[model samples]
Target: MATEDLMRKALEALGEVNGPMSIEVIHRLVDAGDVEDPMSIAEVSDLLDVSAHTLRYYEKIGLVTVDRDSSGHRVYGPESVRRLVFLTRMRISGMAIRDLQHYVELVDAGEGTVPE
Candidate 1:
């Protein structure tokens, strides 16, 4: 599916929910369709409306970790795509890269950090 379509679906899902939006909620919404097949960098870039260079920069800075295919092409799984969705949204909301990095660190630290 196209990134725009997925994003549209996520937004529609978001509209059905109440209360504050959390990472878990967003994840569920984005993962509702759950693309099982891995996607290429260009595909992801088009989906997130960001350039390939931006995606590379995000990976370079440790914001996300994408796997590599046999031919050495970047392969983005559902988790990575979901992370990109959150990251891109946060970025659009004015969260700094350092703050986002810290946030990701906290998230990776454990589920206990959710309340932090």
Candidate 2:
């Protein structure tokens, strides 16, 4: 599927949720539709309405981890896109950087942090 189509499906699914959607939920939404392949950094930036600089900054700050293809160009898969969506929404909602960082650390730490 086209990148735009994939994003559309994800947004449609996102709108159906009553409350905050977790990473798992977002994953399910993205997985519901098949993407032909991973998207490039520029494509992801356009889709998320974020700048390439901001996307790089997110990776630099550990907010997100972007995997590179064989040619060393950044490739954003569905999971990475979902993460960017979540991060962008949080920022728009006024979530502090420190808190977002902490939350990301908690998430990286695993499910145990969910109960804390």
Which candidate number has the best lDDT?
Answer: 1
Top TM-score prediction, candidate number: 1
Kindly report which residue stretches of model 1 are placed more than 4 angstroms away from their true locations once superposed. Answer: 1-33
| True-structure lDDT of candidate 1 | 0.78
Candidate 2 C-alpha lDDT tens digits along 20-109: 444444444445334446888887766665689999999999999889988999998777777777887777456998998999999999
lDDT (Cα, tens digit) per residue for candidate 1, span 1-116: 97656755665576733434444444454553456678999988766667899999999999999999899999999889888888987875559999999999998899999889
Clashing pairs in 2: none
Ten-residue stretch with the least lDDT total in model 1: 16-25
TM-scores of all candidate predictions against the true structure: 0.69, 0.68
lDDT of each: 0.78, 0.74
